[model samples]
Target chain A: MSHISLFEFTQVVKKTLEKNLDPTYWVVAEIGELRIHPKGHCYLELIEKQGEKIVARMKATIWSYTFQNLNVWFEKITGTSLKSGMKILVNGEIQFHESYGLSLNIRDIDANYTLGEREKIKREVIMRLEKEGLIRMNKSLELPLVPQRIAVISSAHSAGYEDFSNQLANSAYQFHISLFAAEMQGKDGTKSVVEALKNIFKEIDLFDLVVILRGGGAQSDLDCFDTYLMGKAIARFPIPVVTGIGHERDETVADLVARTRLKTPTAVAEFLLNGMRSYEESLLRSYERMIGHTQHRLLNESNRINHAATGIKSLSHQLIRDVDSLLRIQQQHIFDTIQHLQKQNDTQIDHLTGRLSLGLKSNLVRSQQQIYGYEQFFHFSDPEYTLQRGFTYTTIDGKSLNKQEAPTIGQVLETMTLDSTIKSKIEEVK
Target chain B: MAKELSYKDALEELEAIAHQIENDEPDIDELSALVKKAKELIQLCKKKLKKTGSEIDDAMKELED
Candidate 1:
């Protein structure tokens, strides 16, 4: 077996580290920690992470003079100071020291590359959210007809909140806004905002919507909102979220996931007020239509009634006139019939009276003739005439007797003729 | 508002139409439509009655049989 000295083994390791790496190469890494020594040398802990797990980590150093130049250049280009948690692009050499272990000797950093890295991270977070199906989750939530109750995630004293309040005050609509104070910037901002959303979810019934407002801060502070954690929080929230980030730059991940992304806090307030105004206008229009329809219906109904009344009046009047004419004709006919009948009866009565008088005179003469004839018969049939003609008869005492009469002893008999009479006395009785 | 009305609604519309006609407010162009509507409503009512009468006849036949 062969063994080498500790110094000899370290030299071999040092040679491998040096020969294995390029002289200068660009690296992408997040600054996990940063510090400047009194001597003006900038020390940084460069790290690469997958979610919360650190996959790679390295210590990097910039020389005193070079630190000054790179910091200034980066701040000028990115509008952000060198700080922890920022992804940086640094061109550096890998150095191995027998005593010191391994370190990256950072020579120069590309400020432009840093900016591009930030943009790339932002796009990656968006892609991740889209793949998770959370990009449109919050945006798809239905906004209430009137979002009166609002849960605000913002600093209580932020200038953006102040502007939002002032805008709402100007509108006639009333809104109930309550602040759930949270840090709106820095590394903790994403967590702060996520926690605020959780708190709102717990009291979700009390709010109609959630509004995350941030403004009047350095542009670099808006970076936290572009993170996957912040976007996921807003997208998965049950209630609708509206973001008014008040930035002139492109929309952040939070803005994309929100129900609406307004340019400023004042614009958000105006959106609410305009919705109310349109709803009110529609209601007023409906009321007007109701009145118009009702009045039209009543007018037409009354016209119909008037028309029926006039028709009824004319028809009844015509019928009454017809009945009146019929009655008058019947009355004239009855009067004429009575007059004709009376005239006929009077004529018959007069004729009958004349005939009766004539008949009575004739009957009286006939009766007189009948009585004269009877008197003639009586004169011709007289017993004195008959006896004077040629016949004699016997009488007893002063009575005439015939053969049927017998003489009595005490009777005196007498024969009488028309002008003379003889008397006799008899004694025999038979 | 729909094109087709339910039986009760059709009856009400018919009554309103008759009232409108009695008012004589429709112009000649509208009068043709109004009269056509009246004919349809009357036909609908008669058809309903006919259907009811058939139903009653069926029921009586069932009972007799």
Candidate 2:
């Protein structure tokens, strides 16, 4: 309690440190807090830690002129902004002030060391996930063929989420999208994203995949994605996770473990729409092939049918001609038969008539000859014929001499001649 | 008399010969000559009738074929 003024004590400490500690010595420390002053200076609280406890802490400053150039060079090389939680190798001088207390004036910082430290932490996260067998877990899940149901993890008003939904809508594919709004940067980023993922998992059956999206921003803003818990969550998710945290240069641990890593949120949308488009194109190709094959077969069949019909038609015509000619020949045969029968009838009638005439003539001649012989015989036997031959006979009283005993003297005698008749009186018998 | 006379003409000549013998009172020489001519006519008629019948049989057989 017997001390001089605070200024005198601060002066004594500052001189002592300037004499003992080397000027512009390089020191390794972590930035526990960082801020920019209105006067264009950078202020940082540097710390050395063992786990969550800080064993050493120091106030450090970068002059505005140095900070302007240094900040640009660091961000250009590391693709990250100077931010809290970053391990840095810096060259600086230690000094003490009466009003403000002890501080370090940083003249230079090695951006590569900060970048390498971040890379080392990212490497450790990846290794831990790998050892737990979670690195390939989400990747092994089969992405749905369509992938239309999407759970989006992003800030509510971010252009990243808008670009993704708009991209899908423009593709004209129906998408079932649900927004799980979350802070995507700063202190609450990792925790908020993890919470969104948890919420999505609560209704896992409803979503085909999850999308973690952010618009292009300071590379350091993506530092939250490099955390072990963030990487682990993505690696172990039941559904596939797609990352589109838009940073041109650096890749975060979350990006590495996600099922798909795209440079931007719009690019993620394109990837999904392109996959569906290719699938649809393949189906269209198969349909065209089927139609072509069917039409080709039908054409061949029609040609064969036409050929067979032509063959049948020709054969039918030939058969008809053959039948018609046969009918004509039969008709001529029938006509000839009729003419021959008529001729036969005429010949039979003529022959029969000649035979009848011959028979009648012969019978008439035979009868006439018989009659002539009979007439001759009768003329020889007649008495009138004998008288003409000089033969005579006498009668008495019209009786023969044989009829009377003797001729009486009074009886009259009669005589007959061939041409003349004799009247005689019956007297005696001859 | 024509030797080639048809059957009708030959029979008519035979009848005429009989009538001359009966109605004209011919002598024996004339009767015998007439009778001889009638016999010739009758033979010719019989031969002609037989030829005609054979010709008709051949014609009938040809028609059947």
Candidate 3:
């Protein structure tokens, strides 16, 4: 067999491919490798496989102008840029270059197909995670009431980081923030975030939550957040993870796997601050409850004391009144007894007076009889009897003289015997 | 008083005392003592709320070291 020169053979093959193959053919393939040239062209190695076996492979190109339009349109519809591992439905032309060999010149891509493929992959990842019970693992973690210790995963100089730090620093409560710097987007984003997570895991006890932060960007910039590896890492992390990737539209796999998902870095900080504020409010509530309970208790105590005091006062008053009544009754009894005794004594005195009066009257009657008899005797023994019996009486100075009497000089004396009377002048007598 | 009690414990005790005072109608002496204890617990809780600073350890520095 006569073989033509290799270059001539390639030229013939290129011409034949151009003449026979359709200028534009729709193809379905997976992007195995992809590179974007600095001059704005895209090169891709496309492959079709059956199970683990690659059945077909081809080199593909998209010129800069075509690539720019297609990229924008694809991303607009699918919310992601074309990247390796994405299955795409593309419109391309079969080309055989004399020097570059067989390739496909891609003219257009179906954004809906790629979108569907991405959804299918995402669904598969979610299903696998659900089956393994990992999808809800981080979400089920109980965040502390006050999650003050934070492990931050973000680009060191990202605006998201700045926003997060500023918001947290301005919060009413202090938070302990330790930044574990990581790339926030592009192909390396997932790996950097996973690595940061691993670092935080080394000292898991020191952190309450892991915050993955990124600022707002094109929706395609969030493609890294949907990767299975990052989702798995966040889902299985010991500490709860909070994501604030600043994507307003899509809920990435990282968001679903994390414990909490806020829309922005500032929102995440607000969430944390709100948590602390609620705790503080609860504390204040407890304080208020305690004060209310104490005041209620004190008021009750005061009321009880007043009640007891009133009870004692009234009881003492009743006791005093009862005693007073008892004393009065006793006084009346004693008065009655004294009055009875006085009446009895008065009656006895009257009886004794009557008896004494009777005795005196009888004695007086007996003494009167004796006096009568003595009087009669005395009258019978009068001086007449004596005179009749020759008895004489003598007197000096009208006073009778006896044998022991002596006369005084210059004084008249009288003597009487019975009825006869005599007067005598003073005479010396011895 | 020398043995330190945690804020939660102090609040718990305060709650218990309040309940006892409310329900039992304790005598004056016991009531006064309970009131004084509740006051101390309130102070302890307030102090905890007013705590000014926090202790932070950067474990990332350990990795750098």
Candidate 4:
């Protein structure tokens, strides 16, 4: 117990540490926490855990010069920059400062260790999700035929968001996209993404799918996407989720759990547009088929109508011809009957005229005989003829003509026989 | 006619009518009517495909109060 001041003791300890510890030592540990100072120094809490217990912990620092070089070197090797929660093998020197206590001054980092750690974690997450039957959950979801309504989960200020929006906006198909802004990287990224997913879930009916998007980044930026929370959120989401986290190499757990995975935000937009385009093609095809079938039907109907019309026309024509022939036959029959009646009437009139002429000739003959008889009687009774026949009548002074009358006076009478002439008077006796 | 039906429904109906006509089941009168209906449905479907509304309404949580 030397009566020395605290400053003197701190100086002696610092000297002892500088002399005993190696200038640079290789150490393996996990970066439990990390922060960057405004001046470009990186401070870290390095930890080694056994099961759930922290067995060792130490403070570490990388000056701006080393940090910048190491950061570039590490990113070039592993496709990612150093980040918290990553297991790293670092080369550093042990330093003891009174004010800061024991710390390590890091000179170099092994990028392979961090890369291996990320891969291991990703494999574990995949295994866990697979065992829980969630790996294929999102992929099995039936995407809408027209996935036009979209819920976009991304950083509003990120280039990925701009690319996605621009691509969709420029597409020919119309899409309804509602952006749900979220942190895309760092320690709080998982929490923010999960929150955005929850927000989308609340209005699940409004969206056909969820798109998780981010621009190309170092692999370290994708760490939050490999977490169990993110995997679970995307896998179990009611609406299918599509991921375009923009990593060129290894697929993140988010990518594996999504319904569709594309390389970039622009690709995701294209995928959505292609879906709409294919649907439209199908619609056009259906329409074309309908039109073709309708045209065929119309043609058939028109042909049928034409056929019927022709049939009616021919049938009517035949009917008219048949009717005309029948009318002609009837007219011929009526004319024949009229001619026959006229012939019968003419024969009757001829017969009646012949009988009338014969009756007139017979009557004329009988009248001529009667006239001859009368003429013969008159000739025989004539005086000349009586004289020739020697038949005579006598009269005394005309008394012979008054034989039956009493003679009132002697009268001169004359008698004549044959041609003899006598005069007679009518003195008469009985 | 087909304007009352949704694009999907109109297409479906058109398919059915076409099927009927293809089978030659309908009489001339019915066929004519079906053809007319199919024409209307085709027009409706084309309109649906060609006509796009420019109204874009956003309900983003970040934009909402």
Query: Which candidate tops lDDT?
Result: 2
Screening candidate 1 with a backbone cut-off below 3 angstroms (N, C-alpha, C), the clashing residue pairs are: A394-A401, A413-A424
lDDT of 1 by residue, A1-430 (tens): 9999989999998888778877888999999999999999999999999999999999999989999998887777775667898888899998877787778889888888877887889999999999999999998999888898999898989999998888887778888898999999887999999999999999999999898998777655678899999999999999899999887767889999999999888788888888888888888888889889989989998999999999899989999989998889888888888888877876676566556545654654464454344334333334454576877656565443543365668777777677887777787876
lDDT of 2 at A257: 87
Q: In model 3, which residue pairs have backbone atoms overlapping below 3 Å?
A: A393-A416, A393-A417, A395-A414, A395-A415, A396-A413, A396-A414, A397-A412, A397-A413, A397-A414, A398-A414
TM-score of each: 0.56, 0.60, 0.65, 0.61
Taking chain B only, the TM-score of every model is: 0.74, 0.76, 0.72, 0.67
**Local accuracy by lDDT, each model:** 0.80, 0.81, 0.81, 0.79
A39-119: candidate 3 lDDT, tens digit per residue: 999999999989989999999999999999999999888877889878999999887777788889999999899888888
lDDT of 4 by residue, A1-430 (tens): 7588889999999999888887899999988899999999999999999997999999999999999999988887777677777899999998888898999999989888888877988899999999999989999999888888999999887888888999989988888889999999988989999999999989998999999999855555778888999999899998889998988877888999999999899899889888888899999999999999999999999999999999999999999999999999999999888888877876675565445444544554454444344334334434455556776554443334434354456756555566577665666656
For candidate 4, report its TM-score: 0.61
The fnat of each candidate, in order, is 0.00, 0.00, 0.00, 0.00
Candidate 2 structure quality by residue, lDDT tens digits, A1-430? 7987777877788788878887767999999899999998999999999999999999999999999999989988887778888899999987677788888899999999988888888888889889998888887888778898999998887888889989998887899899999989887889999999999999999999899999855665678898988988888899899999988876788888899999999999999999799878878898898899989989989999999999899989899989998998988888888878877876776676556545655654554455444345444534445677987656666555565567765566777666665765555555
Error of 2 at A67 (Å): 2.5
Cα deviation of A259 in candidate 4 (Å)? 2.1
Where's the lowest-lDDT run of ten residues in candidate 3 chain A?
A: A374-383
State the C-alpha RMSD over the true interface residues for candidate 3, after superposing those residues: 60.4
Give the Å error, residue A129, model 2.
1.4
